[model samples]
Each structure stands twice: as C-alpha cells, then as structure tokens.
Target: MSSPLHTQPLAALRRQLLSRDISPADLLHSVEASIAQHDPAIGAYLQRDFPTALAEAHRADLSLPLGGIPIGIKDIINVKGQPLTCGSKMLAGKFISPYDATVITRLRAAGAIPFGKLNMDEFAMGSSTENSALQITRNPWDLTRVPGGSSGGSAAAVASGTAVATLGTDTGGSIRQPASFCGIVGLKPSYGRVSRYGCTAYASSLDQIGPMTRSVADAALLLQAIAGPDPADSTCRRDPVPDFSAALQGDIRGLRIGLPKEYFGDGIDPAVRAAVDRAITLLEAAGAELRPLSLPHSSSAIAAYYIIATAEASANLARFDGIRYGHRCDQPENLRDLYDRSRAEGFGPEVKRRIILGTYVLSSGYYDAYYRKAQKVRHLIRQDFAQAFAQVDVLLGPTCPTPAFKFGAHTSDPLQMYLADIYTIAANLAGLCGLSLPCGTTPPTAEAPALPIGLQWLAPPLGEATLLRAAAAAEQLLA
Candidate 1:
C-alpha cells in the first residue's frame, strides 16, 4: 500500500508535519524512493541532489510557503553549485555556477528544496524532448509520446511524481503545450514579471520562466515565489507583484473571454477544439462571458516568432564557440579551426538548422524583407490583442492543436511543429500573461493518443492575478 506521503499534494505533506503524521525525513524519503524507482526509464531528471535536499528539508521549520516541497528545475536556469547544463553536450562535465537564478533564490526562501534539474531541448529550440542534448525525457502518460519542450523534463518530472511541481521556461508554447500533454497546469507570466537573471537565453524577447504543477493553485504558489524583479536582469519589471493565491479567490463574474476565429482555423484537431469548447462552456457557467473574435494578424504569429526568436537565439548562442567556455575541440591546428570544429560538433542538427535559418533571415540583404516584416507583423498581432481586449477582458483558446503526440510525430516536418504553437505565440508577442489548465481528456485512438486538453487563459500585461482567477474558475467547472 502507498503511504500517505506517497500520494498527496505538497501542501498536504506540510500539514502532516504539524500533526506529527510524518517527519520531514520520511516525506523526503518517499520522494527520493519514487525518483529512484521510477526515473530510470523516464529520463525526467537531469541531475538529482537528494542528500543536500533532504538535509534542507530536515532543517526547515514553521509555516512555510512551499513547506518542504521538492521541485524540478529546468536545466537552463542556474542553481548555485548544481549542474546548469542547458541540455547540451557543449557544456557537459560543467558545474561552475557562482549564483542562483532569481527563481532558485526565491524557491529557497519559500522553504522549497531544489532537488534536481530536468532535461530540455538543446538550447530550447524544439517542441519535443526528442531534441534534448541530454537523454530524451519521455512522457509520463504514454511513455512513447513526447513531453513537449524545451521544458519537457520539467513537465515530465511533475507528471511522473519525481517532484510535486517543477519550473519551466516558455518561449513559443514550451510550458503550456507540455502541461497540456502531461495533464497539469503551466503558467507564462507577462515578460519581466519573472526575472530572467540566471536563465540561459534561447530567444530573449520570447523567454519567460514559469511553473508547472498538478493544480492551478499549486502553480499559483510557485508563481508567487518566482515573480519579482532582480537587479541582474535589466528587463525585469519593477511593477507591484500581487499575491496570486489571494487574487485567485476573486469573482470572475461578467468577465469577458475572447475566442479567436483565427486560432480555430485549419490544422486544429477536432478533439482539441471540442475540449476547448467544453472549457469555454465551463467559463460561461462560472460567470465569464464569451464571444467570437478575430485576431486577423494572428495567422502570422508563427512566421514572426520564428524570425524574431531565431534571430535572438543566433546572437545568444554565439558565445558557445568554445574558447573560454564549454567544450573545446581536441584536434585543432589553430584558434579559428578550434572555434569552427567545436561549434560544428557540439550543436545538434536542429540547433544548426535554426541558427542557419535565423542568420539567413537577419542577414544584410534579407533583414528588411524578413526580420523587419516580421517585427511589423508582430506589432499588428499585438494591436489585435489590444483591440480585442478593449472589448473582452481576456482570451480563451487551445493550448495546442493536439496533445502528447508520438515522439517523432512532428519532428520529421518542422512546419508541423511550428504550427503547433500558433495559438499560444501571440501572448508572448504582446507581452501578456497566460496559463494552461487541464480542461478535458480526449479518448484514445490509434491515430491520436489519449491526452489532456488545456484551455489557454490570456490577459493583458501584468494581469496574472486575473488570469489565475479565470483559470481557477474554468478549472472548477471542468473538475
């Protein structure tokens, strides 16, 4: 029989301490046991810190935010003294982070143990864990299917019970799609709400750190811990951070939700559409008004995201040329040869593919035609959201066109994977807050695997409080 420690929320685990039902060591033992027994095939954990984590858990005292909860960190974020590989062999055998990422610092303050780091797409470029420079992080639901990337391992960690919850970075649906795939909640706060100080950059403009957890409230608690300004990141916003958990209790009565016609167009799976419709019905029942709206420029969000994100990626990744940092080529006649050979050998096919595409788009002659046009399209897309928000307080849409697809399902074709993020990219472009929560499940089929559908609730910038309230309301109905 499973112990109470084996199957309960992190919050409940803390309550046991008050009643002396279980010592912190006993609780940590359960988590450590689960990870040891289950993670071999899953590959969710990139690195585990069991002894130190247990030591911290044992020392924790009094009412705490996370209350001795263990968590999984996406490999891109720096956790002082932990292996901070961004899922790449380029940085293999590397462990020299001098500072904690803002989120890690906050997690420690909240009494949460940073137990491990999880796998991700190399440099966070792919949609599935298949591209992880480390081992592939398999989905907890089907094992054969993908746990979406570049935050795949983080999602898989939470879903597989390796941790009660995990942190992920969303840059083009990385967080929400995996959450939808893994049957959990994922939030992407507005840009700057969460500090990006110690995070490795993929697409600086698009990347924002967020949380993945089993419940809306649990994700909310994680968000509270991580969302705030940090001096190291110049882009970190200084706006007042609201208490997300408290704000979730507010009434969403008369709240307006926009359903974009553009997102429901061709390529959207029928099952995904049905699940989102069901979530919409739930919101309507919870006093949220719904209306069909048009984000005409949204159709171009994919093209824009690719150009902008890849351009930023190309620049950010230039540092990995392997002279002062990372893996250097063994047989090099000179400096240029060493730089060329190191990057060429270290970067995976997908990583090379994007760098080439981005370089081409941002090159001298094509810059105005491709990169500049995409930026203009980005403005139009942002305008669409701004105009729509004038009429509707928030937006509702499918988190992904489908769910936990087969491992190689969208990999053969790059366009297919890019299209999967069509519905979620505009929020990032507009710098708005959004979240994905379990809505309904699609029945299994030979062609389509069984997976949870997520309803994406998006609000204007700095609107996380309202976003969670709406998500919780929809979640309550879906439940």
Candidate 2:
C-alpha cells in the first residue's frame, strides 16, 4: 500500500505532523520507499543523502514553521558538505560545497529538511533535462516525454510523489515551464526577491530561485520560508517579506487581468490555446475583469533574451576553467592547451553552444552592434510590462506554446527549442514575479499522450502577495 503522506499536500502534511499523526522519520521513510520504487525510470534525482536526512528527521522539531518537511534542492544550489554538481561532468566529483546557501539556512531555520540534490541542465542552460551530463529526467505524466527544464528533476520528483515540494531556479522559464509540463505549481520570485548567493550562476540578471509544489498554498508556504534579503548577496532586495499564506484568503474580486494579444498568435498549439481560453473564461466568471492588452515588444523578446542571457552565461561560467577546482586535463602541452582541452572535454554540447554564442556577442567589435542593441531592446520589453501594469493588476497567459514534447523532438534544432520559451521569456526579461499552475489537461490522441496545460500569472516586482492571491482563487474555481 502507498503511504498516505506521499500524496498529501504540504499544508496537510504539516497538520499531520502537528497532530502527531505522522512522525518526521515516517515521512522520510515513506519518501525513500517511493523514490526507490519509482526513481530508476523517472530519473528525478542526481544524488540523495538518505542517511543524513534520516538523522535530521529523527531529531526534528515539529513545533517549527515547516513541521519538518522534506524538500529537494536543485543541484545548482549549495548545501553544506553535499555535492554541488550542477548536473555537469566538469564539477561532478571535484567540488563539495563548503557552506550552505542563504536559502538553505532559512529553510533549516523553518524546520524544513534539505534531502537530495535534484538533476538539472548542466549549468542551467537548456530547456530540457536531456542536456544534463548526469541523467535524463523524464516527465512523470508520460515517461517518454521531457519534464521541461533546467529544473526538470525538481518538477518530476514532486509530480511523481517522491517529494512534497522542491526548490528550482528560473533563468528563462526553467521552473515554470517544467511545472507546466509536469502538472504542478512553480513560481519564479522577482529578481532580487530571493537571494542567489549559493546558486550556480546561469544568467545572473535572469536567475531567481523559487518553489515548486502541488498547490498554490504550498508554494506560498515554501516562499515564506526562503524569501528575504541576505547580507551575502548584494542583489537581494531589502523589502520586508509578507505573509503569503494570509494573502491567499482574499478573493480576486476587483483584480484586473490583462490578456496579451500577442500570446494567442498563430504559432501556439491549438490545444494549448483552447485551454488558456477556458482559463480566461473561468477567471472572468470569478469576478476578475479581463482586458485585452498589447505588449508591442513581445515579439522581439526571444532574440534579445538569447543575446543577453548567453553573454551573462559566458561571463559567469568562466570560473570553471580547471585552475583551482573541478576537472582538469591530464597533462597539458602548454597553458593554452590546458585551458582548451579541459573546457572542451568538461562541458556538454549545449553549454559549449551557449558559451560560444555569448563570447561572439561580447567580442570587441560586435559588442556595440549585437549586445548593446539587445540591451536596448530589453529596456523596451521592461517598459512594455510597466505600461501594462499601469492598467492591470496582473497579466495572464499560457505558460508554454505546447505541452511537453518527446525526447529528441527538438534536440537537433536549437532555434525550435528556444522558441518553446516564447511565452515565458518576457517575465524574466522584465524582472517580474511569475507563477504557473495546472489550469486544465489535454485529451490523449493516437499520436500524443494526455498532458497538463498551465496558466501563467505575472505581476510587477515584489507583487507576490497579489500573484498568489489571484492564483489560489483560480486554482479553487478550476477545481
């Protein structure tokens, strides 16, 4: 028989722990058993420390805020004494984190246990876990399809009942896209809203760590534990964190939801469009006033995002050059050869591709033409959101253009894979808070399996309270 705790939401599990109906050790064991039974086929974890987690569970304090919940950490985030591989062979066994990230410290203070290092795209550069040098994490909804990435493992683990909740980093839709694909809830807190001190940098300006859970209330609970300014990170915002759980109580009676006309264009899949349309109707019926809006710069987001993200990636990934730690070449003919061979052998294809593209855009002569032009366009995109927010409380749209695709479907075509993030890249570009939840499901056809559809909600910076309130109401009405 399955453990009832495995399927219970995070809020319910906390209640059970408070009532002494389920002990932390029992919860850990139940998760371990589920992982042992399901993970080989699902591939959601890169590494797990069951013994350490078990030891922690035995001494857990149930009176704390989290009630000893077991949460999965994305491999890119540092957990003291654990392997911080970032799903790349370059740092695979070479570096053990010497300290915990700020978010990990906050989680521990809240009584949440960091249980495992979940798989991700190597250096968080790809749209699918297939880019991981470590393992391929499959979507729990359909084993043959990808759980959208680079946060695929976190999403897959939660969807498969191996975890109650997990943390994922979003650099251009990594968290929300996967949550959409796996039929779960994922949030990318506004840039600077969550500390990035110990997270492996992807695109520093774009990456924000957030929660992945089965419900909006659970996401709120996790966010409350980790969202605050950290002294170690200069980019972290100093705004006081709000009571996100309390925010979920009020209905979105007078909320103004903007439906961007650009998102429903010709390229979107028919099923996805239909599902989002239904969601808009449901929200409208529940007292949210829907208005058709325009983000004129939306079409140029993908192009600008690639140039900026890759350029930041190129600068951030220079630390892994095999000098101090990480993998090194056996014997170098010279200093140049050492740098060349080590990087070539250490990085996977996708990482190499992004690095090269980034370097090209940042090269001396081309910087003004490509990188500068992209930055100018990025400002316009942010301005577009600013104008839209002046008229609406939040913007609503489809999370992805389509449901999860089969493995190898877009592997050979980088452009195709990049376009998959068309609907989500703008939020990251604008540095706005975004959330994705299961709005509906597509029917199975002879050629494709049934898959979940997600509705994305975007709010201005530090507007998580409004975002969660609106999302929770929609979740309840949809249910």
Candidate 3:
C-alpha cells in the first residue's frame, strides 16, 4: 500500500508538487482524509475550513519554497478570518481575527496555506492539552496518554498525519515538551527569532513561535519561510535569518555537547534516561565530545518560570474583559458584574488558577517578594546558560522527565504536571534556541504501550544554525 501523502515529510511533498507528480489540491485532499480518519480520536483540531484551504491550495505558487503546503496553527495564533480561541471559552465562538499575524502573513507569502485552528491549553496555561476547554488531545502513539501542551494539538496533528507541519508557541516548554511526547521534531527558536505580533501572549518575555514537524529538514524549511525581523513586533530580533537548510548539511564532528549534571540526578524515568544516554553515546562515537556540566539554577527553573510566566499572562489576558470583544455577560448588574461573570464563565480551572496566582504575585505586598525575586532568578538562569555556552557548543538532555503520561495521571497535582517540563523550561527563560526529537521508545508493558523518548539540545541565542546542524546529524544517526 502507498503511504499517505500527509504522512510524508514536507520536503518530499514539496518536491512531488514541483515535479507535477502531485497537485496542491491532491495534498489538501490527503490532509483532509487524514483528519477525517485520525482527528476524531486525537482531537487535534478545534476548527478546520477545508473548503477555503482547498481554494487557497488551488492558487498556490509551486515555485515558492513552502508552496501548497498546509500548516496547522495552534489556536492562539491569529489567522485572518479564523477563530482565535486559544482553547478557552473566553474567546470561543466569539472572536474572529481581523488581520493575519506576521507569521501567518509570511506563510502565505511563501505559498503555504494556514488550514486549521488546532487545540491547546486555555490561554496556553497548562502542561497537558487537557487544559483546553474545548477538547482533550491524546497522544497519537497511545490513545489513553496526553500529547503535551500548550502545543499538544500541533504536535498531535503532525504526529497523526493530519498536518504536514504546524506552528506552535513555546513559553516554558510548550513546544518542545509536546514534541517529545508526540515523538516529532519541535524547535523553539530564540525568543525574538520569530515575530509574536499575531500570537496570543502567554509570557511576553519567554514566548517564541516555532515549527513542529515530522523531520528536521521540514522544520528548517518552515523556519526559513516564517523567520526574519518584523517591524510590527518591537521585541523581534533585527538579526538576519540564517540559512537553516544549509546548517543541516554539516556533521557533528568535534562538536562539544554538555550534559548538565543536575538533569541527570533524579526524578527521571529509567527508560527515558537509557534512551537519552544511548543517543549521547551515539553522538560520542560519531566524533562529538561530551562534557559534564552544571546549571545550578536549574533546580529553581519551575518556580521562577511559574512566577514570571503567570505574571506576564495576567497582564496579557486582562485585555479580554467583557467589553469590546470575546465572551461577555449577557445582562450586567453593573460593569464589575459583567467583568466578573464573563471571566468566571469563560476561563477554565487551570487558567483561573494561574491568573489568580499571577494577580497575587504582582499585587502590592508580594511583587517584590515573588515576581521580582523570580526575575532575578530568571536572569541568573540566563547567566548560567551563557556561562555554559561559553564552554560548549550545545547542551544535551531529556526533553521531559518521562514519556507521555496517561490522561488524568497528573491532572490532580498541578505541581507534578509542572515538573513534566523540568528539562525544557530553562531554555525559554534563558532565551536560547532548543529542539526536541525522538531518540527511542520505552518497552511496553501489559498496562501501557511503548512510548517514544525525546533527546533535546539547546543552543545560544541565534545559534539555531548550530542547534539544527546537531539535531539533523542526530536525526540521521538515530534513523
């Protein structure tokens, strides 16, 4: 039997289109068929407009790099005329984006079609896609397990062949953790590497938009299409986007990779450790050098990340009050009542918990004690990475503590859920580039199925070239 077109790598699909072996319409049909077959179980998409997507594909310019490719977008991103729900009832069915986000615009200009509104955590707040008010996104590999969040739907879609590639935002491991859980390549670019003008803010200082794909080369292609300085976003970097595709051609000979001692200490699953350790061994055998290093501040990453992220989320989400747009209280006893009722009715438990915590931390008496202290710790975390990068080309580690967990396993304990991203949050805090790709799988038991383990690597700001090169080499080695 022939493989599904949607299951093929983006580069292969693009080549077929260019050679007249497949048309954009054919690609769209393949994606639609996959969505029809798989999405009911995976719940990857919150909304899909295949009629419009097919129309766009029909007009796609095949000569363009991403031409005719359909990229699924996490719901938080603003795609003109599409729902921008952020997986919360707060904006669900209420807000339709009036303009394209810079990334969406760039994708269009590169001949890619933005096809679906993928599910996510409410306002990008949760560690599991379960926080999405709309639906639960299960790991494609295991129906009972969660695809990690807040980019879970993006990861699920890509893993399930519902999308050729997708866009996801990372604020404290949103992209990488999900990629790990879903067994795909998830790259979180440097904080300013991609414009955030159209993406809904989670943690302003840490949020970055990036690609989730089936392969490293596909990720490089998607990054090439969407990356560059954007004048609309003041926070976007002015640095020229490098040739990411070129980076993939290089080998990892003589590469210096640091394995932070703190990450290897404890709390990691034995299978996860073995899988990552094996990857490290492979890299070493391929002429790469491994050094044991310490990121002492890593222990405080979860704490600092929560404080700073929630603080920023609080400020950003305040705009959704029941007045101009989004969900609103039907009959307001008064202005305050409207605000209270709308927010209370709209937000889910996890989002409300975060907003409340954020509000308290930023409140008069606690600001200096919690929020300010967290920023200091964040800076220290960045310094730690700077110091480490000074000594090594990249840092290698597990993307998360374990493989994807069964749904409801960590739902009751938010702290346990938060710890799932222990290995990934620091990169966001430090403004470094990070990528996660599958290394190996755990041995399945009677109770659970075999699940993929992820190997992660981090690079300094704008060091995506190094990061991708290493990841591409690792991909080849692992394959």
Candidate 4:
C-alpha cells in the first residue's frame, strides 16, 4: 500500500500538517516507506539519509511555507554536508558540499527538509539519465523507457510517489523534458529568477533551477520558496518575488496564447502534435485566444544551443582539474598527464563528447565561426520571443517531439539523442521562463503502454506569475 503522505501533493500535506492531522515525522516515514518500495525499480535516488531527514521532520516548524516537506535535490545542487556528485566518477565518493546552494538556504528558510541525492546525467550533459556513471534512472510509468534528464531522478521520484516535490535544474530541457516524460509538472524559471550560486555549472548562461511536482499548484508553492535574488549569485535578478501560489487563483479568460508555427512543423511525432493541438483547442475553449505566431529563428535553436552551451560548458568544467577536489590520477609522470588521465577517468563518454565539442567550438580558429555566431543567434532567438510576447501573453506547444523512448534507442546516435531536446532548448537559450504539464497520452500498443504527452507554456523573463496562472487554469482542462 502506498503511504498517504507519498501520494498527496505538497500543498495537501501542508494543509494536513497545519490542521494537526499528520505530523512531519509521519510524512518523513511515509516518504521512507515509499522510497523503499519504489526506488529499487525506478533507481531515482543516488543516496538518501532517512535518519537525518526524520530528525529534521520531528523538529520541523509546521508554520513555515514548506515546513517539514522533504524536497529531493538533484545531484548537481549543493546541500551542506551531503555528497555532491554530479553523477560522475569524479565526485561520487570524493566530494562533500561544505555549504548549501542558495536555493537550499531558501528552502531551509521556508522550512523544507532537503532529503536525498537524486540521480542525474554526468555533469548534466545528457537528455537521459543513462549517462550517470552511477546507475540508470528509469521512467516510473514505463521502466523500459528513459526518464528524460538530467533531472530524470527528480522527476521519477515525484512520479513514482516517493517525493512530494523536487528541485531540478534546466540548462536546455533538463527539468521540463523529464517532467514531460514522467507525466508530472516541471517549471524552469527565467534566467536569473532563481540563484545559481552553488549549483554545479553546466552551461552557465542557460541554466535555471526550478521545481518538478505532481501538480502546477505544488510547483507554484515550491517555486515561491526558491524564487528570489541572492548576492551570492550575481546573475540572480533583483525582481520582486510575487505570491506564486496566489497567482494560481487567477483565470485564463482572455489570455492571449501564442502557437509558434515553427514548433508545429516537421519532426514532431503525430501523437504529440495531436495532443498539444487538443490542449491548445481546450485553452481556446477556456477563453484563451490562440494566436498562431512565428519564432523564425526556431530552426537555428538546436544548432545555436549546442554551440553556445558546449562552449560555456567547456569553460565551466575546466575547474574540475585533478589537483583540487575531484578524482586524481593514481601516479602521474607529469602535470599534463595527470590532468588528462584524471579527467578522462572521471568524466563519462557523453561528458567527454560535450567537453570536446565545447572545446572545439571555442578553439582559436573556430571561435568566430561557431561560438560567436551561436551567441549572435542566441540573441536573435531571444528577440523572437520578445516579438512574440508583444502579440501574446504566452507561447504554447508540445514539450518533447515524442514521448519517452525505450532505453538504447538513441544511444548509438548521439545526434538523435540531442534532437530529443529540440523543442525545449529554445526557452533556455532565450532566457525565458517555461513549464511542462501533462496534457494527454499516446495510444498504447500491444508491446508498449501509453506514454504521457506534455504541453509546454513559455513566458517572458520573470513572467512566472502569468505562466502559472495560465497553467493552473488549464491543468483541470488537461486532466
């Protein structure tokens, strides 16, 4: 039997706790029970400390916004005293965070108990958790398929009822894609809306931390706790944090929703296209105006995203040299040999591929042609959204081109795997806030069960209030 605590959303648990119907300790135990029952099959968690979590729950102050709620942290995010592996051999057993990420500090202030080290793509490089050097995280809905990553573990934990909510970082579609695959809600706040301080950097310009939860309201609650500025993250915006939960009460009547023509064309799976079309129709029926618009630069998004992201990743990952904290070579003949061997040994194949691509793009001869041009394209992509937002309140479309794929399907072709993020990377490149929520599912085959489809909504930077309001209003319709 599933624990009631595990099955309920964060808001429901908060209400129950406030009413004295369930204690925080009870919630913790329920989470433990759920993890014990489901984690073996899903492989969502890298490590969990139930004793520490339980103790915190027992002492939790229920009055705080997130008091006693155990929020799972993606391996890339730092939590004081916890293992800080980015799902690579480099830091697996070697690194312990000496301080909390700003987000962790915010969560703690909101009374949330940070619990486990969730699995992720090594250095947040891949779209599937298969890149994790530790273990593969499978989709809870269909174990044969991948949980879209590098936030796969976070999404699986929520989808499998092992976590009420969790934090996932998005550089491209890390949070939103996994949520789409796992049939949950994932939000990637606009760049600088949330602090990046202490988060292991992937592509610095594109990454943003957000919440993955079972419901949009829960996402709002969690986002409320974590969305704010911090001096520690100079990139974090100083915009006033609104009552995200309160924004949910607003209706979408007369809201202008944009349907980017480019997103509907070509490679999208027929089922995914149909489902998202239905979602747009439903929103239209719900009093939203569907304006077919164009993000003309959309065709260049994937190419530009890879070039810029990899280039930034090349620079960000240079800090992991053998001498400091991560894995070191056994015995080095020289410094160069030590550096080469240590990195080669620590990083997975996918990580190495990205680092190499990044390095090549930023190489002296290629910088102007690739990296610089990609940055220019990135600006044009952002301008595309700026122009679209002038005509609409939000942009709506399919989150992923297809539902979760079976394991090993794209492993042989790295480019195929890269295309899995085609629909999502633009939001990051444009530095816009976006969300993914379950809209419907594809038809089940004799050999395969129906997999969930997701509809994504994008808002201008710091426009999460408008984003959440529209999403909450559509949640019931989509359901």
Q: Provide TM-scores for the models.
A: 0.96, 0.99, 0.99, 0.99
Evaluate model 2: give its lDDT: 0.93
Tens digits of per-residue lDDT for model 1, 1-479? 65436457656776786677877677778878888888897899888888898888888763777767777888889989877778888886755677899899898888888888899998888888788877988988888889888789988878787777889999988898888888889999999999998899889988999999888888888899888888888999999899988977877789988888987888878988998887777678777888899988887899999999988888889988778778888989998999889999888888888988889999999999999999999999899989998998888888888877888888889888888787888888889988988888888878656777788889999989889988887777888
Instruction: Please give the range of 10 consecutive residues that has the lowest summed lDDT in model 1.
Output: 2-11
Cα lDDT of model 4 by residue, 76-161, tens digit: 99999899999999999999999999999999999999999899999898898989999989998899999999899999999998
Flag the better candidate by lDDT, 1 or 4: 4
Question: In candidate 1, residue 221 scores what lDDT?
Answer: 87
CA RMSD per model (angstroms): 1.6, 1.0, 0.8, 1.0
Query: Per-residue lDDT of 120-178 in model 3, one digit per residue for the tens?
Result: 99988887899999998999999999999999999999988899899999999999999
Provide backbone clash counts, one per model.
Answer: 0, 0, 0, 0
Q: Model 2, 310: alpha-carbon shift in Å?
A: 0.6
Model 3 Cα displacement at 419 (Å)? 1.1
Where is model 2 poorest over a 10-residue stretch in terms of lDDT? 1-10
Q: List the residue pairs that clash in candidate 4.
A: none
